[model samples]
Target: MKFIDSAGVEFNCPVTFTGTVTTTPSSPATASYMVKRWVSPTITQADLTGGQASQSVNLTGFPGGVVLAASYLQTTATSSSSNGGTTGATLSLGISGSTQAYLATGANVLGAAARLSNAAGTLLGTYRASDVPQVTITATGGSPDLAHLTLSCRAVVYYLEVTAES
Candidate 1:
């Protein structure tokens, strides 16, 4: 039988314990505590204006943690008047001003969809929930005309929170 003193743990450790003997001591190895979560914020069409040459995919609700590989990006743009001769796009994603840390600049953002996976691991530091990671997508190549153009963008960021700093 396993015993728990005071019927509680310091960090809310697991109550049940595993042992090979029928008798056990009051104190046992306490399991480490850690919490992990994910947050994805998307910038909708309503958030953007009709005429624009460049824009940032900055949103809110993300957390401060080590970014994971499962992060994803989805965006689509259409123009009511004209596509603005847009031919190419430059995408940069990272923590704050360091946009090239995670995803390097000119990373083919206009190619349907994009993702931030471990394959291209460039993670540097932890992010804050209040300041959802920023991904600046600057239209480049050809002549990008945002007049009467509606663009919708969305990004899903994954991260892990650990108890001890690694």
Candidate 2:
């Protein structure tokens, strides 16, 4: 069987059947059934500025049967000044209303990409269709005039449908 959305988008569904069938005055056979449904990866991206409050990416209203699978964060563009200070700028990622990722950037220049995942190779938390993820960037510490800094962010998220057994 196939599943289609209002937009006429088709979803991938692989099914298998195993059950018991009996014939009149005959032997009975056992069988089982299973259906595997899946959706393509769904991605979401957002740009955020440095030295500002946390920015959020809302994945609300996404089609059902899709859950957050994985995510990535990178700095697309950035500008920073020493402001005659010692400390440099920083960037971070985290779930909304939770602790920021331990991974952080350093110095005025943009740091390396921050891969967001746990030791188990999973994202920090379970995110449903209508979840919001957040990102934060710390301004260069120094004189306002000299410490001016800005950063653009791009976040990509992958979504997949939950298995029937699960």
> What are the RMSD figures for all models against the true structure?
9.8, 11.9
- For residues 18-127, write the lDDT of model 1, one tens digit per residue: 74333222233344332334444555445544445566656666655343544545554421323546655555555576665555665444544444332332663444
Whole-model lDDT per candidate: 0.49, 0.41
lDDT of 1 at 53: 55
Give residue 45's error in model 1 in angstroms: 3.6
Q: How accurate is candidate 2 locally (lDDT)?
A: 0.41
Point to the candidate with the largest lDDT. Answer: 1
Off by over 4 Å in 1: 1-39, 49-52, 65-70, 76-81, 106-121, 124-131, 147-149, 164-166
Clashing pairs in 2: 18-31, 18-32, 18-33, 19-31, 19-32, 83-146
Per-residue lDDT over 1-166 for candidate 2, one digit per residue giving the tens place of the 0 to 100 score: 6755559877678644376422322222323322222222222222433344334333333334445555545555444343444244444444566435322333343443343342222343353544444444554444332124444454455555443542
For model 1, the run of ten residues with the poorest summed lDDT: 20-29
